[model samples]
Target: MPITYDSQKRIFKLDTKTSTYALLVYRENYLVHLYYGAKLPDDNLASLMYRGRFDSLSPYNPKVEDELFSPDINPLEYSTNGAGDFRISACSVRGENGDTVTDLRYVSHRILPGKPKLPGLPATFAGEDEAQTLELETVDSVTGVRAFLLYTVFEEYGVITRSVRFENRGSAPVVLERAYSACVDFPGMDFDMVHLYGRWAKENSTARHPLQHGIQSIQSKRGMAGPNHNPFVALARNGCTEETGEAYGFNLIYSGNFAIDIETDTRGCSRLLMGINPTDFRWKLSPEESFTTPEAVLVYSDAGMGGMSRTFHKFYLNHLMRSEWAKKKRPLLINSWEAAYFDFDDDKLAAFAGEAQKLGIEMLVMDDGWFGNRCDDHRALGDWAVNEQKLKGGLQSLIQRVNALGVKFGIWYEPEMINPDSDLYRAHPDWAVCARGRDKSISRYQCVLDMTREDVRDNIFRQMYDVISKNNIEYIKWDCNRHISEAASLQLPPDRQGEFFHRYVLGVYDLMDRITTAFPHILLENCSSGGGRFDAGMLYYSPQIWASDNTDAIERLTIQFGASLCYPIASLGAHVSANPRTSLKTRGNVAMCGTFGYELDPVKLTEEERALVRRQVADYHKYYDLIRYGDFYRLTSPTDNPFFCEWEFVSEDKTEALTTLVVMRQPEHVFHIQYLRGLDPDRLYREEETGEVYSGALLMHAGLNLSCVSWESPDGDSLVRHFTAV
Candidate 1:
């Protein structure tokens, strides 16, 4: 049992046995030495983040630390230790000789030139000199587990991002079950009751993580100035489920400010964003489990957006995303449920795809309903094999036509679901996720597939990749129609029933890996119902998601906004299309972000609207690189600033800029205007509206009264401003 701890330095180490697991993270800087769990220690514990220990490299000096460096005071907080800093106090199980009764569980913070174990999380800073390249390595030798860190180092934008990845490469297969909490010292916020929300699971901002029975995520009812700041915080519990199963994940948090990005991964192979808490980790774990390989955590951060993050994560992700790739190499162009409904015929599909080809949209995908003798949404789910009646020909013939259209073809399949009328289900009714002995419930007229069963998983893979392997298909939209998490699979061992969700996902990854290995060029777009189950885990395989079925451009603003907060924009499936929102009459900015494509009939729009869309497609190509790889910044808000919201993409140079300022008219007797900062700080900037010149700070902080006196932004119209450094 290798262990190490540094109480005096407020650092902890576990590289070797006999090394004390003495570190405990309490409140910001106060790490307690828990080497002797039974004994109450002395000055062994002091406020590390407070009094003066901000960091070893840059010691915290209350006098020198600005609001940017110092921890912002939390409004609602009650530490178990009766100390405000105790809000984050944590301790490991008492040492072998110590009693948990007297010793406090100490949390570990990574030590700079020392072993402080806060582990490189990320920097929550905005000032020019506040950023740092902080990294941490956490390993459990006894368990043979490891997590690594790689963080972005831009300090001016007021944030630091770190990505952490971990794996259990041990001898004994063990599940790494642990509770991760974001115990913020921010007052007004309730840690116990605060539920964290982000892009890992949602379509628009409205789609949120499933709640844990009695909790609502901590959101700023009012922003920082008003009463709170809402940074993305998620508490996930995961570990090994199989002997040799490999896993990888990432998390991003922007502290110091709510909306600004601190780090992002733009140069890496993954093309992701945000930050990591760990790095290159080999879990020579469970020599008995059968699997052995190093697991990794990817940490990315941004000044909100820039490099690959800002361009892709912040902006482009919402407009255009590069899929995992295929034989032909391009996104599998898709016409989702919202596009064709049940109106597609083989000839119609081929003719319709003709339009997609005119725009360089690669693989043409047909989503929903082409299976189980199905004609509508209500039937033939989970039923493998194509419905001959719908296509009037076998699946291969239809695919050939799409291929003939000079485009690769993709088909949607929700393998995890089954319709009661499906041949497979009717033969094995119990295969669906239903309450054993009790009637089962179904969503979207289907039940979950018992993927835990080897047979089920095999059946899915067979039709999924095997069918495509036999045909000219190059892409697949893996759709999960419903959340069938509760039903018990009689086929699984009792204790393993709980392992369904994670395993189902893992199975998906395995299937994708196999398919990609077999085809290498076959791309995948994971869809859950519409945009459910959108997460980084899935992204490693499925490069894009169906976004949301909501076609309203206005609602998309809020939706895409929430989505961009966690995931890089490259992952969202956004398109420019028809007006009059489909789901709810709400408006949307269908043109601004994420995989830019159209789901509407290009022929339906008026000539002017069509012309506008045509231009947008071209415009996307113009800034595609910037949007795909620049820095992202939130300039406005749909929150209190609902009348307008703004975002910007700044080149790494800090000189060039591309700003999207959406203006919604308010009856304040005026029009919409945008402001910016760091624009030469003192240099004069020319306004986009007119040849107006003004000092950068004056307009950025105060205001640059702008009036589109001639016209106001349509109730939800936005003005796209492309900036260039003079």
Candidate 2:
């Protein structure tokens, strides 16, 4: 196995029983040659998805062992001679007893690009236990060029950590400039796309390349909150293919200098390339340098985040979650709308949490009905105050009391809205996004607050901060019910009415940014009537989202399956079993592919049903780490691969990967579980329930087959196999 990495002294060293040799020069930032031990065809970076940003003339630094590696990680060695490739040494990788460790595991490499790429570009990872900051200075101090970087070649337990940071340095400063682009090259996909955002019904601009067709890209203004936030959400899936290779398959290009074009390859895969335009502000030092806003270009690879492999990818995200226990992930949690809709109160809330706790739940969130006049969601749209009528006490007191019971407390809030009937709306009246001359009817009992306005921004921010600060609130169900309507006003002038959606989203970001900054300890879940706002823009601010309002497991299967194509599992909110799913038709396990949680009334469940919930929790607890943070691979899409949904999560080293096969037998059964990809060439694993032993070799080569399938598991109907290397 060749576990390679590069710094100033770049080199690739392979490990074998016979001997170890340093592979001669290939280009830098190239890993295919390093991992596959193949020669680069022509050995050039011109076609390697080139990302150029005069603004981001810096490098991305990789974390060295001493800098961040845990016990599972050993540092790089140092050579006898100081700094040349032949002389550049590793930090002497030693086993637990300093023996030449032989059981080499992970084979990895990284191209740590430097910065101008501002600090704090939103990151995605699984598992928790976070350090306070991500401080990697990879730029050349003299030239202001960023080249410092690091990568790991693992030898211990697959536990890995992910983090990123930028510590403001130098006297005269430069504005941060960065790009969201991939480094690999692939063949391409078969379809065109329209990147989407805004309302599903009416959307904004659809991005396209110079000359294109059928496929369009929708740039969503939806976002998780932060200061001066510009959401980076645009799609391109033209040249990437799943049929060709792994790692170097798909990409979304972001040209830091040119108009950012979001494009895909020949496969059906997608990417949201992001970059910032040069702005001279936010700079206090140096000659007046240029600045570009950061973009949200996030994509999830399914291979890195399930089962034990999730532990490997955890290294990429520790900066955000900041909690080790949180990294372990909790039981699948469920909320009420999918369970009882808008049901009971305090005692009711307590009952749900208690029952959930019995079933291994870690937290309980009080959804819509617990607030002021919120029964059925028609009234109290702008109200932030607690409804004494429902909880019988203030929100803080209720939360405090709930915490005493050993369960975390979460609440719902929608500050960017105002029902004209609401007191705030009644008092200000001008607070809504409406026009005076024509008309502004209501949607969902309220209108959106002109989040684009400074005052409106203040009001929203203050109230939101108040809720998190004053109360022991651990989780927030941040919701934005209706999309921008009437397009009249909040803060923007009349001529810029069309700018409402974009600016309004900025306002939302401002509020959320403040809340999260001040209360870094809290976890926020974003929901816009479920999948309505599922996009990369929102993922920047929210760790999880309400996958969909439709709780019907069957319908959810379709909805969530479509959603998984873009988002990662950690950000995808799902539950175990909910009161017989409420949908057009009775369904099967609707939520088995996300941060599993329940939203049902514990008091209402029968003993057997409750036990089922408990069992579901156990299943979640067992696999939570695997699904929440591992790489997400969408093997089959209901839209494309109906009747069969196959996916897997592989550890970083690719040693172990878990695959789940969901078989929908409408009447196609020629089973023996063969003919699937990545089956154990060495096949060593077993069915958790059936205990039927198998070889990793046969499993990977011949695959397993199933006939007479039944939708039984309340956890979701599927075949889950854990492939381990013995």
Those runs of model 2 whose alpha carbons end farther than 4 Å from true positions after fitting are: 1-113, 116-328, 435-438, 488-500, 577-590, 652-658, 668-680, 708-717, 721-726
> Candidate 1 on 1-726: residue-level lDDT in tens?
122344555444222111111234444433232221111233343332222223333323254334323221211111112222212221111112222211112223342331111221211222223223333344444444443332323322212233334444454444322112212221011111112243322344522232232223232211010112233432211221111111112332311111211111111101111221111111122333321111112222222222212322432222112234311223525464556778777877877678666655565777777876778777777677777888877788988888887877777877767888778887888777654677777666777777656677777777776567778877777776565435566776654454444344345555566665677666677776555555444554565666666656666666666556556655676655454633211122344466666666543456665455456656666666555455556666564365666676656555555666555445455664566643556655665545556665665677545576315544655556655544
Give candidate 1 misplaced runs (Cα > 4 Å): 1-336, 359-363, 581-589, 677-704, 709-711
What is the C-alpha local distance difference test score of each model? 0.45, 0.45
Cα lDDT tens digits, model 2, 1-726, are 324324443444433221222322223222221121122322222222222221222222233212222111111121111112121111111122323221111223342222122332333332222111111223223223221122222212222112222223333333222222221111234323323233332212222233232232322222222111113232233343332211111211111121223334222222222222212111221333322223322222223212222322243244333333245454345465555567676766767777767766778777777656777767777767677887777776666666676778887777777877677877787887776665777778777787768887777677667666777787778877776546656455544454344345556666777777777767778777665555444555666767666655545555564444434566667654444433211222235576767665666767877666666666566655656655655555454544665666655444555666665434343443433344445546655556676776666565565544433322335566665555
Candidate number of the best TM-score: 1
Provide the lDDT at 499 for model 1. 41
Against the true structure, what is each candidate's TM-score? 0.64, 0.63
Worst 10 residues of 2 by lDDT: 73-82
CA RMSD of each candidate after superposition:
12.8, 13.7
